[model samples]
Every structure is written in C-alpha cells, then in structure tokens.
Target: MESQVTNNANALRLFFTDDVFVVEDKSVQIVLPAVTEAVSATVSIPKVEAKEAVVVVENTVIPAEKPLPPSESYAQKGEILPIVEEPLQPKAFKFLGGNKKSVLILVNDAAYDVSTEQGRELLRKIVKAVDLATPDFALLNYANYKGTTYAELHQFFKPQIMLSFGVEASHLQLNLNWAGEIIVHETTRIIFAPNLHPLDSDLSAKKSLWGNLQKIK
Candidate 1:
C-alpha cells in the first residue's frame, strides 16, 4: 500500500512543476520521458576452435655427490716429502721376554696388567702346549697391533709363527698373503685360534690352539 502511495506521489510530481502554487485553480502540465535515437554500428567477433594437446615430461638423471679425494701440490725444488713409513705400533702388553723372536702370540686382551702374575699364568699355559727346544716366547696384545700393517709386523716381530687368539685371528690376516686359516707369509706362519677369555676354565679352547700349534711347529 505504501509502494502504491509513493508511485502516485511520483506521478503527481511529473504533472505539477515546483513553480505551481497550492490552489484549487492551479494548472498542471504532463511531462513525458524523452527517448534518444538508437545507435547502430558494425561489431566483428573472431571464432576460436578448442583442441586436445599432449604434454610429455622426460626424467632427468642427477648424479650422486662424491667427496673429493685429498690432493697435495708437488715439491718446488730441494725440499722433499719425508717418506711415510708404518707408524710405530706400541705394545699393549710389553714383550714377555726382551727380544722379538720365534713364536709371537697375539692375545685378544689381558686379565690384568700383562706384566702381573695373572698375565704370566695365561702365557705359561699356551707356552707349555708348544713343543720347542727354547720356544723363545714373545707376546703382543692384538689391540696394540691394529694400526701396524702385517708387513711392518713381520719386519718388527719377525716371528717364525704368529698365533692369534680371539677376534684377532681374522685381524692378523690383514695385509698378508694367505690361503685360508693358515698363513705362510715368507718365514712367518700365522695360526688363527678361538678366543680364550676364560683361558684356564675352557680346556677345549686350549686343546684347539695346542692342536693347531703342533701342526705348524
């Protein structure tokens, strides 16, 4: 109803101008909305065709990053690069007897300081098993010999036979010419033996070492 009243008010505004006086005899003139002439011109739109497309992505191979090897520049003139010899491998346990000789026993570890009574006792058992006129026993803990090469070991100890105990059995084989368990590298004979942790208790380990020791000696 309000919308109809508003529409009628707007219609009356078109009939009576703002200049007309509020009187019963007042005149009203009707004014119609003017329409402009229609504008006509040419508009051209281009046609586009939709089509399918194939996209192929080739796999690129990326090479692994490698560490660069250490490089040294050449010597200029008189100066010389001091020759690098096998580093001195310290004895974990000192030589039982002074000189490096015939039978070098490579022990896995020691019960105590190898110089002690317990160490000597451990040695006495193995030394007794071998049959030799003098025996001239020498002992080295394998832990001491890790850094030393077999070649340097051969040169230093210069043993006729190398008896390795525990994990050192396979370790002593490094840098040495060998067939299997038994290794005959020039003069030195290497015999790999089972671990002797509970040395005195395990009779079989002692017997195994003693048995193989007999073959080489």
Candidate 2:
C-alpha cells in the first residue's frame, strides 16, 4: 500500500511539473477475423471465331468438269512454268430444219435438249401450226449464238421471213423501235412472238401468233 501510494504521488508530480517527456517504442498488433477457406467466384468468357461471308448469284454457269493435273511442284530453281492458252471456240450456227423457202425460225432455249424425240415432236407440231414443214424453215437456237446480228443472219440463211420466239430484235442487234409488231426490215419480214413451248397450251397466244403469222409474207 505504501509503495502504490508513493508511485501515484510521483506520477502526479511528473504530470503537474514541467518535466522532459519520453515515449516508449512498441510494435502494434492488429486483431483480424479467424482465417477461413475462400469461396471461388471465377467468371468464364467464351471465345468467338470469325466466319466467311456468303454470296448469291443468278444465271450462274458452272464451268465444264475436267480431270485434275499431276500435283508436281512447278517452282524449280532455274526453270520456268509453262504458260497455257485456252483454244478459241468456233462460232457456228447449228440449225435443226433446212432453209428451203428462205424462212428463219429463231428460238432462245440453248439449255433445252432439242435432240430428244419429244423435242422433235413438239417442233413438228409448231411448224405444222405455222402452216410450214420441217424443211421449209430453218430452226435456229439463237441462244447458242447470243450476239448474232441481223446482217450475219441474213448473210447466213438469206431469209426473206424471220420468226423470233422468246428473242428480242435488240438481241439480234436490230434497232427496230420504229417497226410495228410485224417488222419489214429491207426484204426480211420479221415477227417477234412468245416461246413455242407455251403456245402449245395457251389458246389466246396461239390465236394471236396464228393471226400474226398470216401477216408475215
């Protein structure tokens, strides 16, 4: 009790008196929460890949099928690759019927197989309807010869009467804006009509074509 009271009296004296103060050096200890197992919160992001754009084409013609050449390395040292040139295709107008009366019948269906029996039968009917025979007029598929001119046709067939089916005068390089339904260019009497295939079933078209046919020559 005596020592306690004495120590308290010294402390009070030091506080009251203008004495030199001293600070004690000590390390600070922080009390944190108890260590626990961490919960996983990993977010996964999916990888995106790029794709090629698609294109659409109309009246697309697939190239002719040919066998692939030998896979030899053409890149040789001190050697040159051979330059290949495609052969020029011949432009001959192949017709079905004989042009006996200097009459021309033009069709625009090259894809259509005219060599078949059905095709021949249909052609026979068409010619008969026009009051002509197979040998009387030249049946030319002008679609095969796309850019044929009036002068070229005239020189080739020497036609006095031309009946165009599913083909325009502009296609034959004829500027016949002034000409009526039945055109009289030079000596050739031209009549532009619908395709022959449709005329077989279309009564109205057949009547109209028949009427127009009489007007030409």
TM-scores, all candidates, are 0.45, 0.50
Model 1: lDDT equals: 0.62
User: Model 2 reaches what TM-score against the true structure?
Assistant: 0.50
Instruction: List ranges where model 1 is wrong by over 4 Å.
Output: 1-93, 99-101, 115-122, 132-135, 167-170, 173-181, 199-204
lDDT of all the models against the reference?
0.62, 0.74
- Number of backbone clashes in candidate 1: 0
What is candidate 2's lDDT per residue for 1-217, written digit by digit as tens? 4564545776788667776678664675667889997978887877777667766658878999898996877677779878897643444678977889889988777667442454456567657766787788888887788787877888788899888777787888888862336778999888876666654567776666677766753
How far in Å is the alpha carbon of 55 misplaced in model 1? 90
Residue lDDT tens for model 1, 11-79: 888867869566664366657688876877667676676666767788888888898885756875688
For candidate 2, list the clashing residue pairs, or say none. Answer: none
